[model samples]
Target: MGPRNMAQGSSQKPEFFVNPEFITTKTRAIADRKRENTPVPRFTALVPRGHTVPVLNKNTLVESPDGSYRDGPSTHGTDRFERRRADIVAAAIPVLNDQGFKGMRLTAVAELIGLRATGVTYYFPRKEELAVACIESGFAVLDGLVAEAEREPDAGARITQLIALFTARDAAVRQGEAVPLASFSAIRSLEGEHRDRAVEGYKAMFRRVRALLESPELAAMDQTDRTIRAIILLEQLFWAASWLCDFDIEDYPRLAARMADIVLNGVAPGAIADPIPSLTAPARPLASRDESKESFLKAATRQINEHGYRGASVDRISASLNLTKGAFYHHNEAKDDLVAACFRRSFTIMRETQIEARALAAPEACRLAATVEALIRFQLGPEGPLLRTSVLSSMPVEHKTEILGHSYRISRQFASMVVDAITDGSARAVDPMVAGAMVHAAINIAADARPLAMAQAPDIVARFVRPIFAGFLAA
Candidate 1:
């Protein structure tokens, strides 16, 4: 009988195959034939009782008397599963970037891919597992780019190449040709083994990027110099995703070239004697009316920076301050209220420092240097550590909007300094907006240097700030 007649008229039971290889071959044949106007032959697969009936295609399977379709594990089936899992991860990355790990919802991710929550859990089992996957995917992409950059002959070229590659990838992502890169802001929100793995992956990536600055020409740069430079480079790239959206995709290459110039040959005019001026004294503490409330805000900012909004519970914040939850409620009505206050405190510090630097009697370039040095000092000082902009991802939309507005104002202030320096011919001609954004990124990431010994503050500024102002390859 013909295949169509056999499927339609046969009363006899079809043979069931127990071997997966045989099932795979037979399934492919039937699928191929079905495309040629041939009917798919009925087939059954032997599965242990209570086991999930393997399916080749949901529509192609035939149900038996026991209501089980005949199918077995096959290469095609596994490939399909992997593709589905990838689709889910791709959908989850943008959500993670926008809402943070604390705000990410598995159901929302599933909905984006037109799947049920159960469909996602079938692969990831838990939200944490899915988050880890998303983070690891980002790491994989970064590692690939770094590997490509390593092929360059020198540190400067490698750094430039890396920036260009990242800009290209980001442009592709914006164009929807690739998945969005996962933000590392919420890595601290992961718990247990996941957090450890993520941290280790980050360290590995850092080490690799640092190696890019190890050529003989840069031999004078010690490990500390390399470490600080690596941190600045990585942080700027991380911050790029936030602002890169402001420009058109067609301008990415130009933007990348400008960014590479800023990194390689800072905003200074023909090599200055001292790219970064030494601060005679540490930054004075920002005046606060209520010391106790200031202490609470500092503690809360640290907790939130380290553990994310969801992970930084009121109990944790209170415990950090050696206060009871009642005391927290007494000072702040809600955690969000305290976070808002922390943001305000951070903005106040930046604004006051800008005002102080603007009033400096030195040149515009020196004024800019003083401003960066003071902010970095404040980041490393006691009662310091301005809130990281990453926390904006975990905030409510209204709060995020308000904080971002304040942040842009501060960035524009730095731009004003750059404009002044350019007009005075003390700084190189560069994009003021981009230069300002780089300065903002530098100070924001200064908090990362807190782990280094306090005595290294000058060293931090020399290796970190000078390279930023004079260029990474500056003498």
Candidate 2:
């Protein structure tokens, strides 16, 4: 009447088996019971693999978005059953495409796939697995890009190649903002460290941009810190190009140039007389193939920076010379390739401008001030807003975060310029790094300062973009 025992020789009932007859007296009931317990699959232990986020697990998973296991009995799971979940993904992909990570819902996917919620649940007993698949697909897309970038000649060329590999206009057209949009969505869905990882990867994109900008002719800084400064400047430009949404997308080139100047040249020292002019692009005679290439790059920069990546089509690039896609491809491989080329050319112009500005500064303070003016010019200029929308919005969050790392260096460069000015009787001597960081921070705050005042926005944005920078440098 108490604890039931099941031994070969004894007559007892196995626990959970209501019928004592099932506990055969002819077998070793203890050994059987122990074996059964050994194989008892713990339902509570069925943590889904793709259970990355509630967003991915609950929303994106089609088959078993809510499926969780139970260790109680063999009431489910078919070894032969592959759990296709195609119906889930088929319907899910469109929603995911449109709304990104947030749109994936198992019930919705089930409704679209013509499966009952339970029917869908039967295959996936857990929503996590389905999310894992979705995540896998995302990674597959990323891997494809990494593989394509391998064909690049050097780090500089590799960035162009890598960017082209993923950010091509054709890719955007084919997928309707495929990689960029999806990644942007995924980043929004991911939480915490996972989000951070995405951010770091995106920043690497800028790292490549910096490498291209810091090429032989433009790179005058032999010091590691200066090189780091250049990298930071490129990062800021890369981010401003990729994600600044409040403004027109075309200004990316101007933005890049000014940012480059700030990092490479530092601020100019002269007193304030007038707002710097939004100078017209100089006329250049592109004659030889080399010149033609340069011109193409320059023109391409102007176009993409003005129009977002999607807006700037292959035809647009070729149309400048009445050329076709074939002709464009003859010069560049793909639209993304062209983007990389455009970025490089933009950096080239910016570098040249920065070098000139550095030379023109009458005092060291003037030089430092020049650096600040150059940065502001691009953002306030016509090209700034356009480039902000077009090129910058296309990059993923991971890429944007990486760009910020480079921007840190630019802040130091600004400070260094101030130091130089003060040393040579140009301006007062002070903490160069701190002063530069303040100005650089102001520029960054303004870069994405729309829809809300960076000075008085939501907590995260406000805390992140505190605009006390100008005051920091005020003499």
lDDT (Cα, tens digit) per residue for candidate 2, span 1-475: 1011122222221111111111111221221222221221211111112110101111111222222211122233442232234224333444444434433566655665456667657754544344334443343343333334433444344333433333232222222222121323344344455455544544443343334433454344233322233333333423432333323334323333333333333343233333332222212221242776775675665455433455456787788768978888887867766566454444333344345556763665554445444544443333341123224334445444443344444545666666776688664434454446545544433333232232232232222211122210112
TM-score, every prediction: 0.81, 0.33
Model 2 Cα displacement at 263 (Å)? 18
lDDT of 2 at 156: 41
Candidate 2 deviant stretches above 4 angstroms: 1-270, 273-291, 319-323, 371-412, 422-475
Q: Model 2, residue 328: displacement in angstroms?
A: 1.9
**How much lDDT does each candidate structure score?**
0.71, 0.38
C-alpha lDDT of candidate 2 relative to the true structure: 0.38
For model 1, how does the per-residue alpha-carbon lDDT over 1-475 read when each residue is reduced to its tens digit?
A: 0011112122332221122211121121121222222223322121111111111222222222331222222323454565455556666777887788878999888777667899889977988878876776566566656655666779998898788877766665554334566788768899997787677767877888899999999888778778878888999898998889999987787888899999999887342355444443334555655888888888999998889877899999999989999998998888888899899889988888788777767778788888887778778767678899988887888788889999999999999999999998878899999999999998899888887674365555555667878788865
